[model samples]
Target: MPLCRLAGAGALTLLLLSSTVYAQSSTATGVSRAANPALSANVLYLVGKATRHDALDEPDERHAADADEHGAESPGARVQEFELRMTSFVDPHVKADLTLATHGVSETELEEAFVTTVGLPSNLALKAGKFLGSFGKHNPLHTHRYPFIERPMAHETLFGEEGLNEVGAEVSWLAPTDWYTEIVAGVYNGDNPALFSGEAEEDVAFLGRVRSLVDLNDATTFEVGASGLTGRHEELSARSNVVGADATLKWLPLEAQRHKALTLQIEYLRGDVGGATRHGGQVVARVRVTRRWWVQGSGDWLAGDDPTVRRVRGLIAYVPTEFQALRLQYGATFSGDEDTDHRVALQYNFTIGSHPAHAY
Candidate 1:
């Protein structure tokens, strides 16, 4: 069959399955998520987010691997673009999501789109089409969901084959724990680190992640998680970054309306293969002064036990409301004889058409 015809059929198949599943779940639960036929048909949820990031200096590869051009004279010389994503429920039990995003790159290079539906049973979910591999907590979440405006020094090297989505199947499991525990595992096309789509990368990868949230008390809480991954590419065979763990503990003092939620979060990762060893740690602290106002700051430094590359980064964010925030970031790195360059970015985040998640 023609490729276009094939793609169309796949999309139709997912939509039909989603509709069938939603009806079954809603009828069983008798949950009134909608009031009328129209409302019921549109019982799906939608979320929209916007962000702006400015690289402060030349894009230098040494410090921020993703910032290969960091300190150039005109950091903003490239173009700016927009992204919009939609997710809706076809039935009470199934949700379909679509993402269409493009920016800066010439119009000729706009990214294609992908849609997938999730089924519920055994607390198991299946994903097809294109999306990101579930590596870290941050990988699956929209950037707006990040606590800081930007990722840490090591994010560039391992976030993606190049730095985006890919075709894959992902399965998720929610362990029946008092606290929330989630695990996501998947395999993808592993396309090279360039075009964000395709069918081959020579070999597939084995990826897995486990996350847990622990509530210590009414005023104290903690979260811990870890991930394991391995993959192969050309000259870079048997690449892996294993055993990364992170935890955040918070101590809250509540008196009158005046409140403080002081949290300390730390993450550690170590590994290397085929000339790439990624070991780094990050420390971050956040302080909330009001119900809707908060301040946060973090510093990160990373060095592969090899000691040939060292990176440093600083992050800050101010949230004025549940739906809006302002963020800033700066980073620098030392790589052998390479130039030490700096990067700076500013971003604004807001949800356009959806209700807040867990926090709300």
Candidate 2:
């Protein structure tokens, strides 16, 4: 059978199974008013000044022609985004989460709407619906949680603006042995514009990841992971494959101390598009300077058929409370022989209502 048909059948099966589980769990545990989904919302605002110069010797076009540079333009002030999130447990065996986002006054988008199994047998769990792919450390994070004003070069060029969000389902298992370890696999409707562009539901994508964590000591910790995704690239009528690895090291002064901490994170991604290959990654370090102040820096690099690009960024932030933060960032990028692009951005974020903990 065609891939689209297979995808459609799989989706229907999962939906029906989830419904049955939900009904059974609900009967096992009586529902209460608290069972109703909880609501929370956040908004992020950004103002920035930026200038881009093409390669000094290259022909000057009105705009730098790069497919990966799709994002809020420079040299302006705009409402970056507003997000509304809802979550709650459906029963003893399932929970649901939904996220909605609006940019400026544009049409609102359903960022995520997924149902996750809660009390599955063994250490297994399943999640299904419109959701983000578990392809990398960065793919599943919401924009408001981003430490930087914009996504890294590698994520943008490789996965597109939204970072692998699609209609999909994921199954994960906690390994029986060792320190924190998990294996996850997922299937998705191949709908991403940058890498996958299948028109029919039969078009499908597959992803897998293995993650592990170790506590080196009371004050330090380490984590590492690898991920892969493959699918039909409808745009080129070819296959696209992406593989990535990531690591993180962290230190804290004490178990209860949240103010004094340092963390370093790195990730590398490589993609095969048709017969060509492209690769890149980013390294970021963050330190808390004081109770309300923090500083961060990151470096990004991309190598491929297109001009190689490197970006460096420095940021300083004041987070008075968990509910609000103000940040100032400066970044510069050099692409091959092209003139360097510079940007200075100021961002503000605020939230209302109770927010849930993010995935680990």
Candidate 3:
């Protein structure tokens, strides 16, 4: 059979399967979700194929060792995640939130469990528990909030594939500056896979971030931030330092604030691992063509001791409502002195209840 014909058949099958699953799940629990309080679930289904050496399925050898230690798997077509989320106000002074993620069929993990202060003096708030580090914008963003299906190569190389998260405590403050400014500092147990795997009481990682937003006009806005992390690499028994900067610009017409918008975002990260420095960057732009249609493109570059890898990606998404989305993405990656790979992915994301808002 022709490749195009085969691809078409596969696409049709996936669409049918996804629709059936969604309908059944909705019908089975519609009443329960409607009656429940502070509980919700989001399911992400992804299907894809790779042409030539599937780098995603066979990540760099260096990181493969680390993933093996934690039983992480390579990229593939599967139920990416079924996230059960719970949020509630514990009392007058505190709020609690937790996310439990089920990957594939058997792997279930506590993705995030944290509590935050409801009200604090001096424009300050405190957070404690296990959560993703606030080292950079990308590190803190969940998969569903990502513009692209895959994370930037910088995250894969500097931190583990899952970025960086640990049992930690954070203190954040809103500055009194004219522009919207905030600063955050966190200390973690340094138990991430490759970045920091030390569990000793004294072995810890410290990170800080400063972010500011400016409104250029009623329709335009710009935000920029800097972040840094210092940690111990127990595997290598060396000191690790990572520094990053990110910026985003957004525009929305006053008349079509709900339907049309444009966003440009970019981030750069540099890491020093035992004196060996590596750097990578990614830039993405998204344009909303209509109330339910959007297109996004991204470019990624990673260079260091290994062969430099570059990738270009484009995505088109349709959001029928606020709770569901369908997206298609195509990407091509090229590594110097290595075979280039092309891939395509289709994803469906749906929420079943009153989900909490994502962080800015």
Whichever of 1 and 3 has more TM-score, that candidate is 3
Question: TM-score for every candidate vs. truth?
Answer: 0.66, 0.84, 0.85
| Positional deviation of residue 12's Cα in model 2 after best superposition, in angstroms | 56
- Model 2's TM-score against the true structure: 0.84
- lDDT minimum window of 10 residues, candidate 2: 55-64
What's model 3's overall lDDT? 0.84
How many backbone clashes can be found in candidate 1? Answer: 16
lDDT of 1 by residue, 1-360 (tens): 699999999999999988877776666667665642221101111121212222222122333443443221234433233345555665675555655543333232223334444657687776766775565544455445556644555554444323435666778888887888899887766663422122444667666788888778777778888877655544444454445678878777546223567878887765454555667666777777666566766666556644445555555556666556656666565656756656666666555555534541
Kindly report which residue stretches of model 1 are placed more than 4 angstroms away from their true locations once superposed. Answer: 1-73, 76-81, 91-93, 105-119, 160-164, 192-202, 237-242, 250-260, 305-316, 328-345, 356-360
In order, the Cα lDDT scores of the candidates are 0.56, 0.83, 0.84
Model 2 agreement with the true structure over 228-305: per-residue lDDT tens digits: 999998868899899999999988878546588798999999998776788999999999988899999999888898
Clashing pairs in 3: none
CA RMSD per model (angstroms): 12.7, 13.8, 13.4
Better of 1 and 2 by lDDT: 2
Summed over model 3, clashes come to 0
